[model samples]
Target: MDTEQQRFMNMKRRVYKIVLPVLTVSLGLSLFMSAHKGLLLTINLILLVGMLFAWLFLSTKLPLRVIEWFLLTLAGIYLLTMVVQGVYTQMLGHGETSLGDFIVWMPMISLLMFLLFDRWPALIANLALFTVLVLPAVPAFPRLNPEQNESLILFYSGIVVYTSLAYFLHQLYRTRAEQNAMLRFAYVDALTGIANRHRIDTWLRKKVELGEETGKLFSLIFFDLDNFKDINDIYGHKTGDDVLRQLSKVVGEELDHGDLFGRWGGEEFVVLTDTGEEESFRLAERLRKALEDHDFGIAGRVTASFGLSVNRPGDTAESVVSRADERMYHAKQAGRNRVTGRTMVSGDG
Candidate 1:
């Protein structure tokens, strides 16, 4: 699954984790408060049993979508029961006809709707609930006192206002999520799923600017698979792609925290680090050795030519990259599978 979908499912799981326990505890209390043998007690027991079942399945590997639908169905049934109870009580002349019991619960139900669905679905569900509440009030309006009329108006207005605000907030959240997804797509390489060249360039420029301001040094290691073209030529590009992916995974594991690794284009990669010349050289040698030791299955033994460059005073991103590129070619010329830097060279020349 993609990161966003995973995040959404995780969020739903967390919501269920909290909501289920709270509902169970509340129902347990209601059962305690109700008469031990009546319909109210019986209904609470049934709900508590359902809640327990939901909690059990939640702890298991039940899909969150199914759980969500189950909860929403329960909510629908509960609302329907409330409406029926209100109508029956009014008909028996034992309760007020103002829908006070049902209306009082609307705000909480509206919040649940917003939490459980996206913008339009939530809005539509809430509007349907509002209509249900409003329809019953319409026929009784002329019989209501002025105070009751005002209360009803205020309640309806509040729901409308709250729904508008919720819709606005959901829209804002969706826009932010879309922007984040777009940014991730732009900066990450599609094939290897590492930072792409654009991200590397942006990172290098920022590092250079930071170094210029703070007088702190940093380094770059530019490397590419030796004879990568030959691999593509002989084994075909599919196997070559697999080799590159495996190579990235291997190199990525060797990097220290705070180091930035990116694909600099086909078969070429770069590493940016806060370490100075000596440490950077050591890191490059480690990467080279790691590559040498790894077997690339059908690609057989494979190695990389590395170029190391430390930041110099007044160095721009282009200049630093150019130096690393030059040294990398020098390493290739000296013989592949070696690291070449300004004052140091490793491997058989």
Candidate 2:
């Protein structure tokens, strides 16, 4: 996974870890506080137990998406039970049929719906809940006293307010999600699932700026597959794509943390690192050896020509990448599987 997606998953796990325990405790307290017996008490007990199970499930190794759906399902069942209780109490005439009292949990339900779901789903759920809450009042509206009419007006007004706020929040969330997806699409290569050229260029410019400010140098390693077209011609484009994907995985395994590897273009890849000239050359050599040793299945053995270039004083992003590209070309001309920037060191130096 990419950094942003990994961070998002971690954040979700933390939020759920805290929320599940709080909800379990709250349900336990509610059961204690209520004077109800029989079915209502039994239902609350069931809900409390469900919350405990949910908490345990969250602690398990299940995927986050599964956990999210499970929690939302639990919430739906809980809300449905509450709706039944409210309607049954009104039918039995056990208490005054105050819409306000009956819907005391509506705001919380609305907030949870928006929090747990995306825009369209949350909106639909909220609207359905609102309809269920208001439907009972519809038949009795004409018989209500003036004070009751005012209360009904206030309830409707609250619906409008709640919906407006929920829509605003949903729009904000949707906008942010779309922006993140767009950024991922722009930066990530579709086929190999690595950084694309745009991302590489952006990282190069940022490194250039950082190097100029702190006098900390960095290097760029550019490489491309040798005899790649022959593989496409002999096998098919399908095998060629498999070769590129496998090559990316191979090179990725050799990279250090914080190293940026990207698809520079077709059959070409780049690596940006915080290493100097000698270290970058060593990394390039290691990568070249890795590609040489790995079997490409149907395409057989595949190799690449590598070039290394360290950041220079007053260097532009283009200048750094161009020098690396030039050296990569030199490596291709010299042989097909050699590093061309620096002297070859012995024994994986």
Candidate 3:
């Protein structure tokens, strides 16, 4: 998983960890407060015990999906019970334990619903609770005094407003996070965790434009593994991937902060540096020696060939890269691991 999803899951897990103790404490307090009332005592005791079982189930080794479903069911049933109790209190008044008054806390429950699950489950739970609460004020339902009816309507309004805001905020957060993840994924290589071809293309294009407009020099080096397919054929594809990742890491570390480096394609990497042809050639030679010297563990004794090109007065992105690619192939033809580049003469190919 990426960083964003990991962060989101960590936060959700923290909330889940807090649920059991918080519910236990809240239900215990309610039970203590309503000890003298038989119906309230019974309801609070049942909820407290249910919450206890939920906590125990969560503490077990069961699968996460099962535990999530179990917890969601517990939360849903508890909220429904609260709503039902409110409806009962509207019909037959409870001395001091008015279920209608507890409607204010429904927002907290709804918030938990959205955090624990997705919007659909939360929405269904909210609608069900809303319907139950509104029934007390409905004309077909048993009538209460005008003041009591007004209180229920106001309570229903609060629940609707609070839950709606909570849902909106949750969705907003999710959308923003998803967009960020997508943007990150678009530019980043999945295997190497560096810039991919598209990002390199964009970066080189911008640099090319800037150099052309201002006469500022920039350079590119296109390099590839020498006999890379041999590693895959001998050791297997997994070890080949490991070698690529390791090579990327070493090369990336050797680059300056102002330089842009990325995987151009399979076993081929490119580097764009803010320098002239000589410096670019030196950089490529340094990278070639680094790879030749470094041990790639299972792959062992790897080498690379490099081709270098510097930005010219009339250069485009494609032209600069093609020149570098051609030089790299020339280096490969001469020998496997060397840097080959030259200053561009007028109309030189």
Candidate 4:
């Protein structure tokens, strides 16, 4: 439900990106062309085509090859040509556009290029080339004023456009960065900063098909802090939490990025390792001893017992987890602060 809502909002955003601009331009042009000859109507038609082409090029699932580039290039060329034509219609004699206007419009064109190519330098270079090639022919465009102070107006106009665009881009980048950080916090454990249980579960579910396809087995290791309640009683919950925090940090730092670690519950941590018996047992033992030898200053000392189990053929996630849970209980029965592993080959009994 949340994902569906996100998609709907995203689709609405895209609709606004295209629809709002075209509609505003169309409304203004419609009134102007209603009084003038068919020139405004022609310009409006071209704008519609440009917008429709943009929607198709950006929204399609197909590869962004030369064909996509060709379409975008056409849209840019068309918009530029129409702008020039409007200027030519207004200019009757030796008219010229200000260099200021040239500067201002360059950034706008650059931004448009960014929207098209999704690369900065490439689009900036293209805009520079385009502005240089087109500026000299300003008199040929309709509705251009080649009169006094025109250069100054153009320069200021360009500055305003560029400043506005830069500000917009900066704001967008900052917003996205903040959003990404927030998402990371939500999915990560607060104390350990490792993948939380929710994330680990999601990861396993996503990879189930891949595991089946490869005929590969996966392992889960469950570890518990024995006498954790006693420690909490003697040391206080704060100290107990600190101990767990330190343990999480050490275990998290030692494991490879491919491994997933999560706080299973109070005083319990689990890991989903990609390796088999020997490697998994070695990893579990390594984590077990690291805590046994180390002393947490406030919490004094603690130990962790671990149980490992491999996935059986055609086993569900729950069944595999149950096997690991059973092994973990056995580790508790034998002694605290040790590692145990078992693979189920037969029935539930």
Candidate 5:
């Protein structure tokens, strides 16, 4: 892949890691506080700091170093909290619990490394369960009694559910990419790399039907290479194919938005310009000259004849195409390598 595409992929990966985790963490924190009576101001501050740190860390280098640093920092915070909680309970003449709580923050710690970051669903799902799931588990960990084992079971159940859901979503993205890739291969020309004749037929039919009621205009520019068969016979078929590929590349570069280009068949192409004959022909001339100036392999510049026409009232696709094709043929007869307007050659249209 190119550098630009690689950069886009990296940015997309980073966005998924950061956005999903943060949202889940925030939601989980809210639920956790709401379900418990011990949501102290200090603990909330600690939660906010840790959550912000996790977000900041998500965008950092997701290697083991970042993870190690985060875990160590979290361990330090927990140690301090344990000491402080001890002091508070002693001052209030209440018993301080012996075992520590850890699984209460599963939403914040599901990912150990950024490199292994899953897609959005994993993080978002954990975020949603933070309070209803983790808040109630404060007294559940560290060898729970039989009565408290339900919290542990529920937490593990959530893990399985989120993992399964995350796997399903990743498959969804993968399947979509594969489908698009296959469609592109099937409907696009392999030589010129533009839409093929099949695509033109399917796409144009839909466009015509759609705009019939909307009153929008679209034009089709018929194009044919001037004396392309001679080039193939003299130079060889491979050279001829190369010339067609190069010609399509030039045409593609000049194509405007809303315009579609395709290879109709051997040495023939079509451009759906979606504009009046004047604008369509203008672009055709530009494409013709571009092809006539470029060199590919040993073959020299190539030239083409083009004919432009708009859809008439009650016009079928075949009729409009025949009219444009006739004009292209007239241009070929009058002189090869010339572009004609909407008029067809005698006995042609």
Candidate 6:
């Protein structure tokens, strides 16, 4: 997993750790404070113990994913109990009291939904709770006194409004988080944690466009692992992937600030920097040497070939990349590990 995803999971685990104990204590205090020693009290005691046990188990070797599922199930059961209590109270002609209690707890339930799950599951759970709460009020409307019915109307209205707003806010948060995740996946190479081909293309296009407008200088280095297929064939694909990831890191560390580096395809990579042709070629040679010196463990020593190109006036992304790629193949043809490139001039083919 990526760092961001790991951090998110850790935060969730911490929240669950706090929530379980707090909920158990709250229920325990409520059980003591209540006057009735009937079925409701028994249920509350049972739920309190369950929550306490869940909290204790959280710190054990039990998997956090299992605990998360348990909490969600527990929350559902708690909601069902509230609904049942509301129905029982209404049947006993305590509609006002029941509705008030539901109103007070409705926000808590909504908050729990937001905390426990992502947008869609939370929305579905809240919708089901809202439906249950409102259904009872409908048929029992005429039987209620005018004042009681009016209060019910107001309370139900508040419930709907509160849940609607909650849902909206949660949905907004979910949408943004999803967009961020999509962008990360789009731009990042999963194996190496570097920019992928699409990101490299996008960065180059922007740099090329900016250079065309303002006379800013930029260059690209297209390179590939030397004899990469042989390494994969000898050591298996797993170690070959490791060599790529390690080499990417080592070379990436050597690049200047604001430069972009990424995988271009299998065994091929690219780097972009705002440097002249000479500096770009020097940077490419530095990268080639760095990989040559590094030990790739199971893959043994590795080397790379590089080609450099300087951006010229009116140069498109395709033209600049094609030139560098052509030089790269030339480097491969001349020798296995080397740097070969030339700068282009305005109006030069």
Candidate with best TM-score = 1
Clashes of each: 0, 0, 0, 14, 3, 0
Candidate 2: the clashing residue pairs are none
lDDT of 6 at 120: 73
The order of the candidates by TM-score, greatest first, is 1, 2, 3, 6, 5, 4
| Candidate 4 Cα misplacement greater than 4 A, ranges | 1-148, 343-349
Q: Compute the lDDT of residue 38 as modeled in candidate 1.
A: 49
Which tens-of-lDDT digit does each residue in 1-349 have in candidate 4? 4764567446644754565466446545664555533654565565556555555654664444443355446546644654454345333332534321223224544454444444455445455645644574544434444462464355435544664575468558658957987888777887666677777777666555556778676778888988899978998888888888888888877788788888877777888888887788888888887787777886666787788887666767777778778888878887667787874211111
C-alpha TM-scores of all predictions: 0.83, 0.77, 0.68, 0.54, 0.59, 0.65
The sequence of per-residue lDDT tens digits that candidate 5 reaches over residues 148-197 is 45534664576556555555666687689779878887998877778899
lDDT of 1 by residue, 171-266 (tens): 898899899979997999888989999999999999999999998899999998999999999999999999989999999999999999999999
Backbone clash tally for model 1?
0
Assess candidate 5 and give its TM-score to the true structure: 0.59
Clashing pairs in 5: 24-127, 31-131, 32-131
Off by over 4 Å in 5: 1-8, 14-143, 180-186, 190-193, 206-217, 227-245, 295-298, 343-349
Please give the ranking of all candidate structures by lDDT, highest first, separated by commas.
1, 2, 3, 6, 5, 4
Model 6 scores a C-alpha lDDT of: 0.76
Q: Which of candidates 1 and 5 is the stronger one according to TM-score?
A: 1
1-349: candidate 2 lDDT, tens digit per residue: 4876778777877877787788678767766776757766776677678767866877788887776667666655665665455444533245435442424434655666776677778788778866765676676667655665566667667766786688788798879988998988999999999999999989999999998999889999999999999999999999999999999999999999999999999999999999998888889889989988998898988888888888888999989988888888888877778887855422221
lDDT of candidate model 3 versus the reference? 0.77
* Residue clash pairs of candidate 3: none
Q: On a 0 to 1 TM-score scale, where does candidate 3 land against the true structure? A: 0.68
